[model samples]
Structures are given as C-alpha cells and as structure tokens.
Target: MNKSSVTVQPLRNTQTKIAIIGGGVAGSTIALRFAELGLDTTLIEKGPSLVNGPPICHLHAGGNLYREISDEQCLTLLQQSIETVKVYPQSVNVRPTVIALPKTDHGQPEDLLPRLEKLRKRYSELVSADISNKVLGEPEDYFRFYSRAEVDALVNKSIPSKATQASDWLISFANFTDLNKLKFPVLLVQEYGLSAFRFAAIASLAIERLPSCHLQTHSQVTAITADEDNLGWQVSTKLQGNDNIQQQQFDYVINACGFKSGEIDDMVSAKRQRMVEFKAAYVAHWPQCQGLWPEIVFYGERGTPQGMAQLTPYPDGYFQLHGMTQDITLFDQGLVASSLQSAQPKLAQRFIEKIDKKWPEQLIHNRTLGSIEHMAQFIPQFSSAIVAAKPLFGAQQIPGDDPELRAADVSFHGKHYARAEIVKASSALAAADAILANLSECGLITDPAIEGYLTEHYFPVSQQCSDIEVTERAILLAKQRDYPDALAKNL
Candidate 1:
C-alpha cells in the first residue's frame, strides 16, 4: 500500500463540523476559517474572552514572529492577523520597533550598518511601492536603524528624558550619564501596546457574531475522544464553576491552547510533552509619561542577569518588560514544583529595578499588571509546535521530502489538529492555513469549490514550517553568574 495513494476518510455530509479549542489568536483564526467555509464551527474557551490572561505572550505582537521566521513568512502571518481583526481595525495597530544594542566589548558597533542593510533588504521585498504611508513610510521603511544622534533626536522629539542630565535613547545601567552605553539601534514591528488587547477583544467579537459559528466561553474542554461511529471526535467540556460536563461530537478539532495543549492531547493520546519556562515582568508607566515607543529591545552586558529585556509600551499607557530565564537541563520533576506565585514578585521586582536603574522616570509611579504566573513562559518542544491530525490515526508524519505535506506541521491523528506555543497571535493565521491545506491532503475534503477558495486564499510559505531552535541570546549561558536581588531566580 503506497502511502501517497492512501485512501482515508472524507466528509460524508456537505456540512463539515470543526471545533476550535482555546480562543486565543490561532484558535480564533481556525474558527473564522471554518465559519467562512460555511462549516459548522464552535469555539471553546475557558476564559470569558479571547484575550484571556497570562499563559501566552499576548503583548509582543508579530514582530517577534519576524525574529523567528523569514521576513516573507512574517509578513504573511501579519497580513492574515490584520485580516482576522478586520472587524475591529482599531484593535490592530502596527508600529515601528527599536532594538538597542548596548555597547559591549565583543562586537563592533559600526558593523550594524551592514547587518541592518541586509535585514532591510529582506524587508524591502515586502514593501508595496505604490501603497506607501506618511507615518508608516514604505513597508521597508518600517524596518530601519537609527544612530545615536538619530535616536537622541527621536527621543527628544517624542518623549524627552526629563532628567536634569539627558541620556541616550536606549535604557541602560545606573550610569546612564556614562556616554559609553550607546550602540546601534535596530527597529522592527509588532501587534503590541493596546493593539494586543484589542486583538483579543475584537477577535472574540468578530468570531462570536459569525452566524455559522458558536462562541462558547466559560466552557472548558475536559476530554476529546475518537468517535468510532462518526469517524470524528467527541469533545467534552465543562463550564467553569460547574461539575456537570457537556459533550459535542465534531468532524474535526483544533487545539491552539498554547501552554495547555499537551493536556488536551493527553485525553486521547498516551504521549506527554515538556515545557520550557521563561520569567517575565509587566510594569505600567504613569499615565502622564506617554512615551508611545514601539517594541523596544535592550541587550545587556554578557553574564548580567539583564542579558535581554524587551520593553513594550501599551496603548493604555503602560510598559511591559520581559527578562531572561534560568536554564534547566536537569529535569527536577522529582522536586515539588515551587509555587509560581511566590516567585513572581521576585521576578517583577527584578524587572522593575532593571527599568528604574536605567530609566527611572517611567516607573516613578506605576503598578504591576496581574499575577506572577503571567510572567512565566512555558513552551513545549518546538518539534511539536504545530501538528496536523486525523481523528484516530494521528499526525501524518510522511517520511522523506514532500513539500505539500511539509507545509506547516499538518499532523493528523483522528481529525485532531494542534499548534503548540502560539505565543504571538500572528502565527495563528499560518496555523489555520496549514490545517486547511493538510485537511485536503488527508483526503478528508475533496470539494473543488472549497479547494479553489483555499488555493486562492492560501498563506504563501516559501519554506517548510519548523520550530525555531535558535535561542535569541547566548550571553545568559553563564551558569554560576549571580543575579542581583531584583534579578534573582524565583523559587
């Protein structure tokens, strides 16, 4: 039996059913896709709204997606994301981002020109020559590098450092007055600030109002099992504050739950997965300091606990700072997991001090976002980030080279699809596209009309989808380096 010609199951009825578990960006997109296709779709989320708290990185926007994937891929993801939030355009805002490369003994600051030249070259291909914006510039203009003078000028023009003694644009050490902290600054883009919050609210609104879609909140999925009779899946969900469980059977199920995906997979499969935890902090500036800067990334000296601190200013007038994480090669699953809350305050204070020591005025009068658990970053192995599925058969792990099956992780196991670590919402667009393409490849839906629509509207992927294996920074690899009280590791 040649696998290429393998005959699987197809939709017996014209009305195909799909259940999108988790209402974050990806799940929401999947729901929208099925709805647009006129399929019977249901969106299940434990949270009251799509923009639920904590687990995922709801703030970074798609710029980080740029850092992980190719420029073209990133652009497509963002475009899809923009389209998803189209119902509430105000919910999506794309702004310029700046990454400050603080002076270090290692690299030449002058080298930034060539490196940025290349990055911008890649960005150039994405620009629409005719559709340029005065504020956004050409699409390529969105990606640029500003020297010290340029940075200082922009800072002064936008949000001047109120200090009696002025400093460079980049946030730095306590000795900000020390001119030595300056280096090259690079800009990117993101779905950040208030845009991230709006992305969630509007996505929920757009999905809920769809006539073919049923948006169910306060509902938690407890179990997902294979339906032997329907050759589909039975999803069991329980509403919050209630013990009784309700179930629904669907032809397909998509798991875009971020950190909790493996939990849902466990309901039907025996496999379990691991997650990498990253600690972060969210600080809101006083409403008065309206320094609406785009996503700002600051790189610290090697071995310092501040190896990486990305500063994001919200449309609501707050700042979010995400710091580094501790490396755990040895699994201490044996040790009782420390209370994540007890460690959050320590992480928050550490980030607060990092910001204060560098830019005191911002946090001069501010508040913490919410729980510390919100600060922890838990990512499952990248290998399983996105998996295409069949109801009981599982992911179609086709061997050798096959571009069609290779597009995204089109894993299929009993009509169950899952994408892990969907931290950035933009990735959701690609996930939905992948599922549609893979579903067709699995011989599940052979309608030429639906296929034609998908082909005409597919998210172009120049390269196969794979987990980003590169750790953004290696300076934090120093094992024994001591972190200050504020930057110390939480329990």
Candidate 2:
C-alpha cells in the first residue's frame, strides 16, 4: 500500500491497565506516558498533593539522571526534561544556569591547576559534540572558561573585603547567560521561579493517562499477595483516618516508593538480600548572609572538590545552599536547622576575620533563615522478568487476629555509611566517558566514535560506592518470583 493510502487504525481491545504505587517524578512520568498512549492508569501518593514550584536542580541533578545514560541519550533526556518542564509549568522548575569552578583564595596552590586542567578538558569535550555542545555554548559561539585570577577579580569586586580568607575559594559557578556571552551569577540575580506543586501536578497528569490507573492517597499499602492460579497480584492497605481496610489487584505492580521499597518488598514476602539506603542532606539560606560567595563555590582541603556546593537563587530574595554530607538521619527540619546553626557562625567568623585583615568596608554577616532538609532513598530499576520470580507477597497474618507484621530489617536511616570520595575534575569527566563506553559496548547505539572522544578528553579521578553489586542483586530478587538471592550470579 502507498504510505498515504494506508489508513492507521487504533487497536480495538489492546488497552493496558496499569497501577502506579508512587506519585513522584518517575511514577508520574510513567503514568503520563501510558495514559497518553490510551492506557488505563491510576497513581497513588502517600503525601499531600505535590506543590507546583520552580524546578530545583536537586530534583533532576546529575547523579540522579545523567550518569547512567549516553551523551546522545542524555541530550534527548535533557530535551524531554525541558519540554516536560514547559508542559507542566506548575509541576516543574527550570533555572537557566551554568556551573563554574573558581580558584581558592588561600593561594594558587599546586594541586589546583591539575584539577582545572581536567575540568577544562572535560568541559571542552562536552561542548565539542554538536548535540551536547548546543547545551553548553553561548550565543557568541565561544566556549566559556574561567581562570583563577578572573574568578578572584569577580569575587573582590562583589565582596571587596579583607576579612575573607584566600583559603575560602569560590571554585564553581552556575550562572544564567543568554545566547550571547553576557553572564551573571545566579545568587546575584533572579531568573526563573518554578513551583514544586507544579511538578507534582504535571506528574499527576501523566499518571492519570494510564489504563485502569488508580491513585490512592494517604493509604498505606501493608501487604501484597500473588494470585496462585493467575498472573495477577493483590495489595492490602489501611486507609488514613479510617478503620476500614482496602485491597487492590492488578496484573502487574511497579514499586516506585523509593527508599521505602524494602518495606514494600517485605510486605509481599519478597526475598531481598542486599538493599542499601544512602542518606543525603540539603540546606537553603537567604541573601542577607555576608561573605557568601557570589558563585557556587566547591571547598576541598586539598583544593576544591568537583561537584560540591550548589548555590542557586530561590524565590523571595532567598538562595539555596546544598551540601551532600555523610549524615542520613537529617531530614527537613533537623537538617536545615543544623546546617544554619553550624554554617552561620563559622562562615561569619571567617569572613569577619578576613575583612579585619584585608578590606574592612565590605565586611558583613549573612545568616540564612527558614532552612529546610530533604531525605531521599534511591532504588535501582530492574527488568520485569526478574521481579516476577520474587513477587513481593502481601503481609503475613498472625493467628491471634493481630494484622501487624514485623517491619523489614532495613531502617531508612540505619544502612551502612557509603563513603563520598572527592574526585579530581578529570576523574569526574572520565567517569562520564566510561558510562558512555559501557552504553556503546552494550550495543544500545551505533556510534563508537563518541567513546574514543570521551576517553581522550576526560580523565578518571577517585571512585565512590554509588552502586554496589549487592544492590543490583536485591533489585533482581525483589522483581522475580523464582530468582531469589540464591539465583544471583554475583552472589
């Protein structure tokens, strides 16, 4: 048949019925895609409806999304992400910002240059690719670069005080620049404000599109039961503020409950051998705080560590300062309050001392107000075949009419402390290259040239325990009915 003459007919009975357990970005996005494709979909959220807000980098930062995918795939993802932001303006936030690394004020130390060279090479390689470079290039068509001296000059002009120590270096910068070369620091200026609610709303929109989608809010799913004679599963839940119990059955179940996946797995009697929960802390402050670097500055005793502090301007004359520390128990209130209490005094004292020794006129104390903390548990995704073998069975019943099951062995905050290694800039770039190489090797794409370019341009630095083989095995076990920990190849 001729292309124009061929009539496209919609499937009469090919609709898919889907149920999403969480309403976060991933779940909501899945829901939307399925719904758009005319599937029956429902999304359940444990918390209140998501508040629409500006897209925070924390929600979609590098380690969260970019690390696993190839450059071409990443670009496509980034574009889709940007488009998603536009579609759900209320549910997403996007700040047109660029990251910069400034020099330490203590001195042009020996170890600093090598780090810069590594960063420079990686930065160049990213821009060298036509697709990736489009995201990095300025309107003037020149690549952006910063020297230690230039960063210092900008700092002096902005702060202009003797109290700031040279050791207090401003190494990284995330600025908003036009297609033209004109650029300004995010803290010094305001660009976009996205509501957190908006992101959640858009996610809801996406989830609603799935076939047979059901979203239960404030309903705690306590158990999962697999059908003995069919390919289906049942979920048991206790409704919030009600004595009544509820149950749901579906052909398939996707547990996107994040760090809480282990508990959900236990409810279904799914055997999960190795699930690790890593804790992260975030802090935000207002603009009145003095001695605050204009650009996002990364601090390392040996010099500046790659990807440390992320300083971004928030709505209502406030700025968010994010640092990923080793502590996992610290969440919203505790994390924010502690960061302000600890950071304010030390930063103020340092800035004041530097001012007393250097330029006196610019000395000021900048204290952050209204601090907030967030704790997230990341669980890796596994194939469906793996999950079917270890179908998370619903909670076990006790003989004495008690419906409670013991909690899972894993505590949200009690997992082993994963060490954070400060990688050299070159090393960070090299890791990205390695990820690209792996993607190429898997035959996921046709391009082999990108891997070679990534190798030549980026250098590898220190490695951290972001992903452990045990975690992957746990994911596989949780997914399947037959492949328990005993079936794991690595184990």
C-alpha lDDT of residue 234 in model 2: 76
**TM-score, structure 2 vs. true:** 0.46
Q: TM-score for all predictions? A: 0.62, 0.46
Instruction: Report the number of the highest-TM-score candidate.
Output: 1
Best by lDDT: 1
Q: Which stretches of candidate 2 lie over 4 Å from their true place?
A: 1-12, 50-56, 59-143, 152-195, 205-212, 273-307, 326-491
lDDT of each: 0.43, 0.32
lDDT for residue 382 in candidate 1, whole number 0-100:
12
Give candidate 1's error at residue 361 in angstroms: 23
lDDT of 2 by residue, 134-245 (tens): 3323322211344444544544344322224332323212111111221222111111223333334334433333333356777677677777853456777777677677
Question: How far is 189's C-alpha from truth in model 1 (Å)?
Answer: 6.5
lDDT of model 2, residue 215: 65
